[model samples]
Target: MESSTEAYVYYDPTKQNAWVDAILNGLGPNKQRYYKVASLQLVTLLVIVIAKTEYFSAISEVETTSCAVGLMNMIGNKGGCAVRLRLYDSYLCFVVSHLAAFTNNCERRNQDFREIAKRVLFKHQSDPSLAYLSHAWNGGGDEGVAYLAHHGTVLDSSKQASVFHADHLIWLGDLNYRINLSEAEVKQRLAVNNYEELLDYDQLMIERRAGRTFPMFEEGPVEFAPTYKFDAGTDRYDTSAKRRAPSWTDRILWKKPILGREGLTQLNYNNCMAMMLSDHKPVQSVFRAQIRELNRQKQSATRRALQQQLTETPEEMAKGTISSSFIEFDDVQFLEYKEKTLVLENTGQVVAPFYFLAKLDEAQAIPPWLQVSPQQGLLGPGEKILLQFEIMIDASVSAPFNQGQELSHILILRLENAKDFFISIRGNYQRTCFGVPLHLLSPMTIPSVNAEASLTSPPERRKHLLQSAKTTLANPSDPPGSVSPSSSSSSLSTSQQANLPKELWRLLTFLWNKNMLTLPNLFLEHGDRMICDYIRKCLDAGDTFDPSILLGEEEDQTQEAVGANSVIDVLVAFLECLPEPVIPTQFYAEALAASDAPDRIKLLKDKLPPLYRNVLLYITSFLADAIQYAPAAVKQDRRSCIVSLFTVLLRPDLAYKETNPALAQLKKEKLISHLLSIA
Candidate 1:
C-alpha cells in the first residue's frame, strides 16, 4: 500500500501566502491525479492542508471540512487543526497540533492539548446569504441541496463531534515534550548514545506513566537521537546562553480505535538529521492501518436480523455484587500509609464490565490521597477481583486534612448497561502540628487524651468539637486563658501572647539538657521510631519527657545512650515540620543580604516576626554551645556540618531550586554560619 503523507508549515502573511499555491503546484504535473480536500490557517502561527490521491478520492469521500482552534492570542500559545475522512462506512480523524514550548511549562502543554481537544468543532458549511431569505426559499434552494450533498449533518451535537468519536484517529505534530534532566546531564548521556536511560527522564513518558497527560495514547519507541535543541544550520547543540536541554519535542502519538476494530501497527519512526535549517529536527512516522469496508444495505439488513433474533430469545442482564457498600480505614497519621480492600464479584450468568465513575464537575474519580487500583475492568460470570484502596498524606495534600476537613468520599460504581451503585468510604485523619500555620497553632490549647478520643466520636459530636477549635484558633487576639468549647474540662489553656510555642521550647530544652547535640551524626541519621513517637506524644500532650520511660534502666548516661539521637532528631523534626520555617520564606532575601552587614543580628531581628525571631535565636544559641564544646578530633568540621543541617531546616522551601540549586543552597549555608558565629 502507498503511504499517506502530511505536512505542516508556519504561516507568513508577508509572503502573500505563496506556500499554498506552491504546495498544490508541487503535487505533480498531472493536476487531476490529486484533490485538495481542505485548507485552514490559524492566526499567523499554523497552516494546515489536507489533500488526497486520485485513487483514494475515487474510493472514499471527504466527510467534513477542516476546522482550526487558536489557543495563542486569548488563552495560550499555539493551536490545533482537525479534519475527518470517510472510507466506506468508517470515519477516520486526522489532527495536527503545536503545543506550548519550554521545559518548565510542561503542564501548560498538557492544558493546551486538553483545551484544543475540547474546543475544536467540526460543522457543515452553509451560505450566510441564505439564512436572511424566507424560510421556504432557503429550505429547498440549490445551495442548500449542494451543501447537504457535500457536507451533510455529520455530527448531531458538540459533544459527539470530538476526536474520540472517530473509528480511527491519527494525531501528529510538534508535541514539545522535553527531557527532565539538566543540560549537562543530558549532554553527558547523549554523548555515549544512551537513549534508553535518557527516556526514563523524558517529561512526556513520566507524565504519561503518572496518568497526568495523554492517558491512553501510545507511541513507538524513540530509538533515534534527540530531535530538538540544535544550533541552526549545524549539528552541534545550542551554544547560546539559554543552553536549552535537548528534547524529543517533535513526535507522533496515536490512540487505538474502539473495541471490535482492527488496530494500527507502526512501520517506521525516526528523525531527519541532515536538514538542520531550524533548531528542531523534523520527525516522521509511518503506520500500516487496516480499514474495514461495509455495504450500507447489507449492514442495515444484518442489524435487523440480529434484532429479530434477540426478540425471539431474550438475553440475561448483567449483575454483580460487592463485598461491602461502606469501607472505613483506621485512623490516618501524617505521612503514613493506610489501605483497605474491596472485592467485586460477578454474580450473574452474563459478563459484567464495571468501572468507577467520577462525580459530576470533578476531574478525578477519586481524591488525590485515595487511589483505587484497576479503576475499570470486565468480569466473567462467577469471577471476582480484589480492588485495593489506599490513602497517603504528604505535604502537598496535608493542608486540607490539617484544616479539619474530613477524609471521606462517595464513589459511584457503574456497570455497563446496568444500574449504578454507590460505595461510601470514610477515614479519620488525625490532626498534627506539621502542616498547621504558626499563627493558628499558637492560639490553640493542647487537647487532653480524652479530648483527642473525641476524633473517633460520632459525626455530629466530632464536627462540633472541630468547629469550636477552629473558631477559637481563628482569633489570634483571644486571651491566654481562653478555652475551646470542646476542651473546657482539660487543664491545658491557650497562650495567644506566648513568644514561641511551648512544644518547640520543650524539644529544644530536652536536647540542651541532655547534651544530645554532641552525638556524632546528630541530625544526619534517622532515630528510633518508638522513641520518636513517644517524644511526639509528649510534645502534643504538654507533658515533659520522662527519662525513666525512654531510657528504661539503661543507666549509661553517656553519648552512647540510645535515646540521645532520638531526642535530637525529634527536636530538628519539630522545627522542620512547622508550616512556616523558623526564618519565614518571605524574609529569605533579606536574611541573606543581612549576613554580610555589620549588624546582621539586629537587621534580621527587626525584619522577622516575633515568634520567628525568638525561635531562630533560641535554636542558634543552643548550636553555638554545642560547637564550642565539640571534641578536638571533630571540632573543625562540626561547625560546617551544623551550618549545613540548620540551612536545610531553617529555610525548608526550595521552590526555586530548579534554577540554581547549588548557589541558593550555598547562600543559605553562609547565612546560617554567620548567625551561629554571633550566637
Candidate 2:
C-alpha cells in the first residue's frame, strides 16, 4: 500500500474547474483507497480538502474544521481559505490567499491580508448528544438541552481567534506585490542575473522593512528568478504592450506561535519552470516541522518524583540567600530615573525557584513606578542572578509624590517549598514645584527647618508636619505664614513673602546670576543628573545656593561651570509640573484667539488669576532678556526657542479631543509667538 498523503486546494471556480478536475483525476485508484474528502466550501471561490483516511485514526479521534473569507466584488471571488486542526498536542492552521494585484497596490494587498486574518472564523464541531448528557449529569434542565440543540457548533469566542490561536501557522498565496523598479530597469537587471539587486526593489520587502506588514512572519530567501509576468506556455517575459515589471508575486510565509517550542525549518524554496500554463509560475517550499506528543504515564511519573524530592529534601538544601534585606535610594525628583541592583544566589545544593509575593490588596508585586526585572526565576545550585530595581516618576504618577508622599515599598520574595524573605525599599520623594497648585504655592512659605534634622526626626512627627502643610494649602482663607504647631519655632519669617513660589524665584535668579540664559540648547537637552539632584535638594530644603558644593575644592579655575544646563532643566521641570498652567484653563480658547500681542497681554492680565498673571509676566520678561543678550544673528533663534519651550509649558493641561491635536498645538504656538514678538 502507498503511504497516505493530504492535498488542499484553493481555486477560482469561475476559471479553474478544468484544472481541478485534472488534479482530481490524476490522484488515481489508490487515492480512493487511502484518502477521503473532508470538506468542500464554495463561496465566490472554492476550498477543497482531501486527507488520508488513516490520518484521523493515527491522531486519535478529533474534528477538523475549515473556514473561508472572500475579498473580491464584496465577499466574492478571491480571498483566504483556512483549515484548522489538532495534531497530537499542537494546533495548526494553514491559510491560502490571493491578494490585490498591480505594482502600486501594495497597501491594498496589506489591507487584504489584515482583513482575512481578522475576519476568518472557524466553528468547532461539538457533539450535541454528548453536551446534553454532560449537562444532565451536572443537574441542568431543559434550557441546557435546548441550548445544545439550537447551537450545534461552538464558535471560538476568544478576544483573538482562528490563526492567532494556532500553535504553528503557514500562509501561502499569490500576494501580488510587484517590484518597485520600472520594466526597463528590471529587464536590464534580470539580463545580468542580478537577483539580489532586483530584490532590493521588491515592494513586499520594502513594506516589511518599514514594518507596515508581515512584521512577525518569516520567509525563505528567493534564489530563483522572478516567478511572475511570464508569457503563458513559454519561459520568455511578457511580450504584450502593457509590459508589467517582473515581481516575486507568489510567496510562502510562516510564523511560530509566541510561546510554542516547536521548530520549523525551510529546506527548499523554488519555482516549477517546466509547468508554465499560466502567466504566473507555480512556487513550492519544503519544510521540516516539529510536532509535540504527550505521554500521560511519563508525565505523571515525573510529577511524582518531583513531589517526593520536594517533600523529603533537607531544609539546608532548599535555602537561598539575598545580597541585602534593605535597599535605600537617593532622593528621587519628578521625571527622574534611578536604579539599583540586588543579587540573588542559590546557596543550596538543590535547584531553587522563587517569586515575589504581592500585597493582599495589590495585583502586582511592586508599585507602579518601581519595576523589578526577573521578578521570578529558577536558579541552579551555586548560581547567582542580578535583579534590577528601577524607579521613575513621570506625569501620570507624579501628583502623589509631589504632594509629599514618600516613595517606599516592601517586597516579599518566596522560595517555592521553602522560606520567604522580606526586602524593604525606601527613597525620599523630594517635593518640587511641578504638580502643586499655583494658588497654594504662591502665598505658601517654605519652612526654615533643617533638612538633616527633619530626616532624622520621628516618623510620626514627620507625617504630622506633612499633613499639616497639605491642610494649610487646602484652606485658602488661612494666613500665608501660618505654621504647623509641631514646627512653630522653625516657621518662615513674614519678610520672605513673595508673589511667586520661592523655588521658581531661586531657579530664575540662578540663571540670571550665572549668565546662563544665552546658553544654546539649555532647555532643549537634559542636564547633568548629579548636579540636578544637588540643585533639587537645595531647593526642597529652602537653603541658600552654595557655589562651593558644585565647584569642588580644587576648583580648576579654567573649567567651565556645570550647573547652567541643570538649572534650566529644573526650571522647565517646575513649570511643566505645575498642576495648572500659568495661563488658566478657562481662558485657553480666548488666549489662542487673541489677534495681536497687545490683545493677548490684555487677555492674560484680565482673565488670569493674580498669581498666574504674575508668573507669566515674570517668565516672559526673563525670556525677553535672553533674546536681547543674544547675538544679532541668533536673536530670531532665541525668540523661536522661547516660544517653543513655553508654548507647551504654559498651555492648559486639558486633554485635546480635537480631531487634529497638531492644529490645536499650532494655534498655541501662534499665540506664544504673538506674546514673544512684543515681550
- Please report the candidate that would top TM-score against the real structure: 1
Clashes of 1: 0
Candidate achieving the largest lDDT: 1
Which residue pairs overlap in candidate 2's backbone? 434-577, 434-578
540-643 in candidate 1: lDDT tens per residue? 56677888765566665443345765776666666666666778776666766666673775766656655556556667777777777666666655665566
Q: TM-scores of all models?
A: 0.46, 0.42
Q: In model 2, which runs have C-alpha deviations exceeding 4 angstroms? A: 1-324, 330-339, 343-353, 379-384, 392-403, 416-420, 428-444, 447-497, 510-567, 579-609, 628-631, 651-661, 677-679
Error of 2 at 400 (Å): 3.8
Which ranges of candidate 1 are over 4 A from the true structure?
Answer: 1-318, 347-354, 448-497, 514-526, 552-554, 557-561, 588-605, 650-657
Residues 417-482 of candidate 2 have per-residue lDDT tens digits of 678889999998766655666665554465322332332246565566556545533443424433
For candidate 2, what is the total of clashing residue pairs?
Answer: 2
Clash number by candidate, in order: 0, 2
* Decoy 1 TM-score against native: 0.46
